[model samples]
Target chain A: MKLSIDRQIYSDACISKVVYWLSAQYAIERTLDGTIETLSISRNDGHPFDETELRSQCLRLLNDYKLRQTIDDETRDIRTILYAKAFADDENLTVE
Target chain B: MKYYLLPFKFTRIGDHEVFVNEVGDMLHAPIGTAEQIVNRTIEDPELYKSLVANFFISEIRIPALLDVYAERLAEKKRFLDDYTALHIFVLTLRCNQNCIYCQASSRDEHCAASSMSRENMRLAVQHMFKSRSQYLTMEFQGGEPSLEHDLFLYGIELAEEINQTEHRHLTYVLCTNSINLTDEVMATCKQYNVLISTSLDGPSWLHNQNRGKQDSYEKVVKGITKAREILGADRVSALMTASELSLNYPIEIVDEYHKLGFTSIFLRALNPYGKATDNADWEAYTNRFIEFYKQAFEHIIELNKQGHVMIEEYAAIILRKLLTPWCTGFVDLQSPAGIVNSVLIYNYDGYMYASDESRMLAEENDFTFQIGKLSESYENLVYSPKVKEWSKVWNNEAIAGCSDCALQAYCGADPVRNHSTQGDLYGFRPTSLFCKKNKAIIEYIISCVIDRYDELMPIFRNWIR
Candidate 1:
């Protein structure tokens, strides 16, 4: 099965996470050309494949991870400050 | 209006999107609520305030109460400050009953060679005091700890003698099968105020079948009765391990515990260790155990509704994580993983292991988890090179699949279980039965809270209380 994901809509990190999860049951190969990333997936045990289900799962995971990426990007600094304030002895963190 | 996003993770449960923060506070919103929150389009006044109040968002760039948020986050991980409180002493590997699935790899009662030597016992006691924890729990386990009565008694006496100068609040627990809870054992327990934690699988036929002994149930029941009479009912508690056969009888198992007058039941599943490693299909068993847990939990809820108070201990631990700001002492459900952070095992083989399951792995000649021998320094044993390797995979916040998981705060990391089941310390979460079982059950509990909040919250509140 070949999945062509638009890079503008989904990210490499998001698509990579989906592939990592499916790596247990499937052998997935990825290649990027221009803005489109193609995922070539095959079953690990040579069993029958569910193309529609697999595609839908990839899309859903991609959406979820993209949202997670947004959250991480927004909160990374604050999270660092939270941990420093919580554990660091010097408590040198300051938020503007 | 406009608000800045705080750190939170979300997953779909039932028809609602459940959002959990770093401190494990859960907020159930509509399906598109997360996208709305991220896009800064939340219009519901109540939902917006809830998101702000619950630490999911901030109206300002930095909330005024960030210190409070930091404190709550620290409080959830306060178990790290306590060091290793629960120290397990594997007194002997000799057991009376022949269990079909013995996780401890217990030998027959006649196997005195498997017992801990007196020199090792004294050294283990000395090592226990080396921990700086103000509170220490000295738990004795064995094929049957009562088989080594003299060693058990000596361990407690030595702890008490040292505690006079050490000034630590000490608790002693005896993990036994209760078949051989003799008068002498009861006297020793009474003298030391030691708590009895015994096993009762279920009813007679089921318990006897799982135990591989015909009269096992009767003897255990009689032992429980005697222990309660001599050592107060509150001091005697029981735990039930869900065997392959026991999974078919969840309601029967819960009812049996209630019938035996137990206030709480820890419906634990079989780990991949010792004789239990013989299980043919762990993935199927994990799925079945999740179903069994739900069935038994529903039955427990029904019992509580009938004005009978019964607590499912596993749910209570998860509930404490979700509902309270403080962390639980449960070793299996912690971030740094429980092995050495919360527990340590002084095995009968004169070597220190990371956890009880670590010692069980040692019985199978897999000493990947062995810390060091009893003769070594406490620092050397705890901070060994093997422990350093384990520490790499111990934190769930850093693991691959678990790092981004919405349920990471409610779940834990187990490098030992991963190594045992998957042949590596850094386990693949997609195929991990431990991961599957915990996620399914934690999601089921959250679904219950969403679907039947009013009906189950009071009962859950009482259980956590």
Candidate 2:
């Protein structure tokens, strides 16, 4: 099964995570051409592949990860501050 | 109209999208709620207020209550501050009863060279004090620790002698099969106020079948009765393991615990070690255990409704995680993966292991988790290179599949389990039984909260209380 994901819609990190999870059952090969990333996935057990099911699953995961990435990007500084304030010796963690 | 999104994860549970915040507080909303939150289109005033109040969003660039949020996050992980509190002392590997699925890899009753030496016990006690945790739990585990009664007493007495100056609050626990709680063991246990944690796998037929002895259940009941008379009823607790046969009778197991006067039962699953490694299919076993857990949990709830008063311990742990901001002391279900952070094992083989299962792994001569010898410095053993390698994969926040999991806050990472089962410390989460079981059970508990709120909350609140 070949999945061509547009980099504009999903970051490489998001797509990579989806592939990493599927890697347990499938041997996935990745190639990036400009803004398009393709995942050539094959079953590890040599069973017949369901391209539609696989594609839908990947799309769902990509969407979820993209939203998660947005949250991470928006909250990165606050999360760092949160940890620093929680654990670090210095208590003042006001962002200037 | 406009608000900044805080870090949270969402997943579809039945018809609703359940959003869990950074600290594990959950809120159920409509299907497109997360999309609305992210796209700045939340229309419901109540939800908007809830999102802000629950630390899921901020009206300002940084919420004024960020300090409170940080403190809650800190409290959720405060177990790290306590360092290693639960120190397991493996007294011996000589068990009288031969269990069908013995995770401890017990040997014959006459097995020599398989017990902790007195010098090693003394050193282990000294090592326990080295931990700065104000409260120390010295747990004696075995192939039936009662088999080595003298060693057990010596260990407790040695801890007492040293604790005179150390001044730490000490708790002693004896993990024994109730079949052999002799008068001597009972007396020592009484003097130290040691809590007796014994194994009881269900009714007589089921329990004996699991234990591989026809008369085992009769002896166990007799021993339990004896222990309760000597020690208080509250001090004697029993845990049941779901063997292959026991899976056929979840209600029977729960009823057996209730019948024996146990208010709570930890419905434990078989670990992948010792004789339990003989399980033909773990995926099938895990699937069955999930169903078994749900069925038994439903039965427990019904029992509670009947005024029987029973708590399913696994649910209580997950409930405490879900409903409260406090972290539980369950080593298996902790992030930063409990190994040395919350527990350390002093094996009878004169070596220090990362956990109880680590020592069990050593029985098969796989010492991957063996930290060092009892003779080694606490600093050297705890901070050894092996432990350093383990720390790399111990945090679920950093692991691949777990990093993006909607249920990550309620789940934990287990590098030792990963290593033992998957041949690596970083396991494949897609095929992880640990991940599957925890996610299913936690999600089921959440479903109960969503669908049967009024019916189950009273029972749940009492369990956590």
Candidate 3:
């Protein structure tokens, strides 16, 4: 199956995340054409999957990865702080 | 109404979105429920109440129970609270059988130099007592630990002598191929009340084929029976590793165990180590193992329905996380990755490794997980700079892909696996076979609970009990 995803909407990193999970099921090859990212997917052994369901699942996973990316982006500083508070020594330091 | 969202993730299981919170509290809400919660537009009063009760959403701007939630999360990770409770002493690399997928890379029985010396065994026993853990499990492993009957006996005797005054609760386990389990080994096991943990691949032909011996299955079965006769049926147990050929015979494997009168089966996957790395394709094997696990689990459930008490241990471990607040002592599924925290390996070379897999890696000439030397103090071994490094990426919550996973609460972090397979301590999740296998199995287990709750719950409860 060949599908072109809007690179503006889904970053290469996000697309890679989705592809990583699907790599076990599908042999995925990615290429960049200007602003459009093309994904060529084929089953490792069996016949090709249904294009509609495959695309839908891919987009769903892409959305999830993007959401997680957003969460990770937003919470990066807080997570560092939390870890520092939980594990690192900070007895002499004051929280501003 | 204003609301607060706790740390959680959701995935579409069947038609509904199942949400899981940080502490493993879960709720199956309808599609678009996540968006509604995000937008603060969940209008259904009952759904809202369920969300709040299940720790998905809190109505208070700043929840008063945040401290309590932190405490509960700490409780869920209580395995980290205990010191290394399981100390494995790999007595030797000498064995009788040449199993095809032998992870230990065992040498022949005549190779006396491959076995642990009495001095190392004594030092290892003293090291075992150094841990402040009230409960300690001293497990014996080997090429075949039973081959070095003298070392095994001496190790146990030293531990028993120390426990006379130190008096920490002690449990002894012998992990053997059972082929070398002679009358002497059985008598020693009976004396110390040592539990015999043997490997049984499947029925006769499959078992023998995997072990590279025609009568290996017979020897193992005979060993199991003999051990049970002396140690009591409940004390002796067996575990199976799904080799490439074993994948094609899940039901047969379950039947073999049932025929042997064993109540539980741990359908463990093959690690990519030692001679077992001969497995051609792990991705294909993992998928097949998932199917094999589901089929065998269903068969076990059917047997339970027929009034036979049987359990699939992997399911039981995941189910404990899903159905109860208590955590399992299983090392593989732990966040700190069960290395050093829950289990440590004292190899014949006098080096203490993080886990059994660590020692196996050492056999392949990789010492990535050798934490310390047995000659060192337990304090230095447990609190080494290397162990401090492992603590960094050992939590799933702290990992990149695993952090956002809905099953993170049920799953764990394995730095050793990641380091071995992916060439790093922090694993790449998207390409992780560990993540793929655990996710598929855990999701399948939850699907069973969700799709066939009434029919399976009684059986699941029976197994856990």
Candidate 4:
């Protein structure tokens, strides 16, 4: 199955994360065009796979990873402070 | 209204969005509710109140209970406070039965060379006492531990003798095939109050097929019954590994346990180690096992409804993580990759290994996880440079793929597994079998709780207890 995903719509990192997951079942190849990225996927061992199902899974995973990226972007600083507070032993430490 | 978004992630589960926070607090809300939280457009006052109350969203710069939350998080990870509590002693690699999926590579029963020496056993027990843990579990494992009667007895007797003066709470467990539960073994168990952990795959035919012995099931059942009679039924427990053949008979397997009057079953998966590495396709096997587990778990729930006290132990472990503020003592599901943290292995070869699987990898001549020799001092063994290297990738919150996962709170890190399976200490979660199996099961459990909320709560409550 070949998918031409819009680069603007989904970040490359998000697509890569999804492809990494599906790589166990599918041999995925990615190529970038000017504004579009194409993913060429085939069964890993020449076994049977449902093309429609794979497409749905890839799209769903892409959306999920995008959400994760957003969360990572939004909470980066606060998460660091939380960890520092949880593990740091210095009583004089301050997070500003 | 201004809202401060606490760290959380949401996934669609059967028409509902399940939100899980950093501390594993979960709430299932209607679809698009996740969007509402991100967009700050939550219209329902009660839903917004729940989000704030559960640490999903905060109204202030930090929640008023930030210190309390931090304390609770530290308490959940209390396993790291103790040096090590579970000490496994691999008595020998000699065995009587050739199991189809034996993770421990076993030699023939008469292979005296594979057995742990008396000197090694004494040194290993002495080394176990060096840990400052108030409680200790000295677990005896083997190709068939019962075959090495003298070594098992020696190890236990040494621990018991030490505990007399040391006064640490000590418990002994014998992991055996149960085929060789002779009277001598039973007598020792009775004397020491040793708990018997045995293996029973399924019905007679299935068990025999897996064991490669026609009379294997009969011997095991007879041995289990005898041990139960001697040590009391509560002291004997059985765990089953779901092989390819066993996948086809999930109901029969649970029914078999019920017939044997066992109250709980641990549905374990096959690890890629020793003889079990011959498994051709793990992706297909993983999918099959997930299906098998769901079916078997439902059957267990049905059994509970039918007035039987049946529990699925794996689900119980997950429930403890999901429904309670406490963390489970199950090493496999721990953050820091449980190896050398919660449990350590004193191998038959006079070496201290990171985990049970660490020694199995050694049987194949791979020594990535060998901590040190048994003769080494406790300080040198634990604080060695090799262990220092492992510490970097052992925490799930610090690892790739896992760090971003919403189920991160419920899942754990497995550096040994990553080193063995993926050839890296830091695993890639997208292609990780450990991640796949856990996420599927945990998500399915959450979905079940949402889909059958009122009907299944009582059943789930019973299982977790």
Highest-DockQ candidate:
1
- Give TM-scores for every candidate, taking all chains together and pairing residue i with residue i: 0.98, 0.98, 0.88, 0.92
lDDT of each prediction vs. the true structure? 0.92, 0.92, 0.84, 0.88
lDDT, residue B20, model 4 = 85
Put down candidate 4 lDDT per residue, B54-91, tens digits, no spaces: 88888987777776666667667778777689999999
lDDT of 3 by residue, B338-395 (tens): 9988998899998999988899999888999998778888889889999999899998
In terms of lDDT, the poorest run of 10 residues in model 3 chain B is B61-70
What docking grade applies to model 4? acceptable
Candidate 4 backbone clash number = 0
* Backbone clash count, each prediction separately: 0, 0, 0, 0
What is the lDDT for B100 in model 3? 86
Evaluated against the true structure, the overall lDDT of model 4 is 0.88
Instruction: Show where candidate 4 strays beyond 4 Å.
Output: A1-19, A22-63, A89-96
Model 2, range B1-465, lDDT digits (tens) per residue? 788888888998999999999899999998888888998999999999999999899999888988889889999999999999999999999999999999999999898888999999998999999999998999999898999999999999999999899999999999989888889999999999999999999999999998889999999999999999999899999999999888999999999999889999998999999999999999999999999999999999999999988989999999999999999989999999999999999989899999999999998899999999999899999988889988999999999889878888888999989989999999989989999999999999999999999999999999999
Instruction: Give a tens-digit lDDT track for model 4, residues A10-87.
Output: 998898778877876788899998979999999989988888888898887887777767767777766666666666
